[model samples]
Target: MNTDFLKVLFEISEALVTEELAALKFLSLDHVPRRKLEAIQEPKAFFEVLQEKDLIGVGNLFFLKELLYRICRIDLLTSLGSSREQMERELRILGRALVSAYRQLLYRIAEDLTPEDVANVKFLLQKLLPKNKLQEDASMLQIFLEMEIKEIIKEDNLEFLKDLFQRVRPDIKKKIEAYEGKRKENYSREEVRYPVSVQPEEKGAEGGAAKEHGKIYKMKNNPHGYCLILNNYIFKNPSYNREGTLQDGEAVKQVFTWLQFETVEYMDLERKDICDTVKEYSRKDHRNMDCFVCFIFSHGEKGKIKGVDDECVNIEDLVSCFTGTNCPSLAGKPKVFIIQACQGSEPHPSVKVEPDCSGHLEVDASPLTSIPDKADILIGLATVEDCVCFRSHETGSVYIQSLCEKMRLLCPLGVDLTSILTEVNNEVAGKELEGYKQMPKITSTLLKRLVFKVPQ
Candidate 1:
């Protein structure tokens, strides 16, 4: 999105051309034929309208490839303007983008770089020259053009780049593959987390942490608590899509069985009155509790976790009930919420966007990674905001399978709090289909490292 390089390149080059008394030949002069401009503009037109549709005609494909190449060339010329400083800036930026585009073109395009091409470009980057005298660098561009056609994808100096591509390429290929396969993308972004600012809490400060009635109360625990709230078929959605809900509810129901401080399982309540069921759990004291956890398994959208009547419940409203002031039992403890729903409300491919297409960085909810603080609350979400998170007919969600697996291994090894989550994410995302792969993102804000077993 930043085009300041182009402006600098133009200014520096204009000054140098005048100083050198050189005429604008080749591209700079009006002497180049109009047919060339037509060639450059054609690809821009096609790519602009290019959607997820599979396969473009040869005519269109040729136009797009030419357009992209021409744009890259112009960007190079613009970056090298007459000023040495400006040339350096352009060289750095273009060098990075070219290497990247070269990689992308490797899988997407039919070509690779040649030895002469690589050597010449590498020289231009490492060597220093002024923008007006950019001819030194420009000479190498021809070699790049020749090398572009010959088949060669060098492994030299590309391990880091290759590793990065390995981590992300699967996801990108998934999008391309899915679009080619015409797979549906309806269940991806169901869980949306709106922002909430919580003031820092110091224990025993405000009225010794008072408790209120007729509301969901947070119970105290040293580190945290895992809870399970299961809804019967009365509450589950019965859609037939692969991503649709299952009647068993094992995902949300399994949290309570663990041997930990205070476990609660509330079932069969009015769907609209699910919060009332939570109120019932709050009043029923679990003596000597450590922390708090609430699991809501139902179907809804926006930031609201849903219940039986299909009534969507705002996540904030449900989780807010267990705050220190409201639930003294959890005054100095963390409150964990495990949500089995989508975060995104629209269609999204699990594919990672190329760096050039990196969308505006925005703050949003991820899984354990979205923790707001190094201490306090952790929200383990089901699927990323968009895309279908898989749940086997017998095994629940794929992430949960890998999650429980990691915890089985890491918890006993005394893994740090964050590291365990990290491992779980890795295990889960590692599973791949023909082209589909799912990755879970984490967000947390907990103060303590929890080893998930009886502390010896």
Candidate 2:
């Protein structure tokens, strides 16, 4: 996990401080002094106060941990003089606290595990435990958290769920001991590896433009594809609130043009129109192209992006339109989706850049049919899921500008797409606006490096 992502999570947890008073009462601290509780605003101070009374326990430690994460985010983690040992000590405390509290949290989540909730739990577990190590654990919790569970969970998996329940509430551990056996089918981690480089098809001295293996390869001077830009500026639906994104659209269009793509711009589309446009675009002949680029600028919520009409389209469903199975011409080509939208509505605290500064910025399975796990696709989100992304009414989004700048400079020098995106992440994360910060998330499954070589 990226530290910036952890920082965002910590920042979000700060909003749950309303649970503080209840946490205090649950810890058996009625006898503890008010002055002491008043001083327990930050993690270290709070923990010290708890140390005095030895009150941290499973009943309230989870709340304490949440508070500590917030404290670390706002102050302790960013302090200049904090030693590595001091940081490690804090982590050790958190680790110890979690061991005593995880079962309860896990148990609560298991009681109602929607795929969305499962994704959130998985994020936490991945943060606390190494993914590979978690996979090796025969514990029912591990099995449930595995990615395969997203596809199917039937009667065969019920025993594992029962095992999880038994562990969380040990009073039933003995009663459910018979259900603690291995899953009927254990998931081995998927193997993911890519070739070093794939050569472009030879076209005479002009550069061979021949299609090989049903894949359209790029050539200098002609990209053989289009850049689809969906810029929703004059949002008709008042509920969806319009954003000033024309500058972003123009900037992206200019950059993609410089990169040798023919830009296709769509302004203020309705939700159904957005889907129809993509489906219509997918029908274009892509036999001479190297890849496809789709940039969507809109408001969004968890798992879905909204068009001007406030109608939402699941990002997965939108991207699925261009999948290899649906659009055979792009079967082996890269499909890049750059979404410049808020994944959630939470705004970052404003920072004063000069002195105070301000800043900016899921999966599941189904019954009838689900999007087949697609390959050769890359989605560069402006921010993590469920977070607001910032834009400069003056300069465009922090993400789009940085991305265009980096790609413009890096692609000409032969930088691969992933490497360019890493730089974009660094550039965007380094910026602060009105006390807010943004980080771009890149999810890619390309089997070969995707470098936009400048057409010679």
lDDT by residue (tens digit), candidate 2, 1-456: 224333433554454353433343223233356456645654445544553442332112223443334233325333322333433443443112222222333333343445544454444456544576454322434444342235223323444444444544444444334332321111111011111233454433233322322223344337646899987776675544444366577667666776778889998888899889999989988887868999988776677767777777887888888888889999988888888876665655544543211222211011111234788888888876556777655345777766875664455445577877887886666656556666668887776667675654
Evaluate residue 288 in candidate 1 and report its C-alpha lDDT on the 0 to 100 scale.
Answer: 66
Tell me the lDDT of candidate 1.
0.40
Residue runs of model 2 more than 4 Å from their true location after superposition: 1-221, 238-243, 347-372
Candidate 2 achieves a global lDDT of: 0.56
Q: Which ten residues in a row have the lowest lDDT in candidate 1?
A: 190-199
Q: How close is candidate 1 to the true structure, as a TM-score?
A: 0.42
* Candidate topping lDDT: 2
C-alpha lDDT values of all predictions: 0.40, 0.56
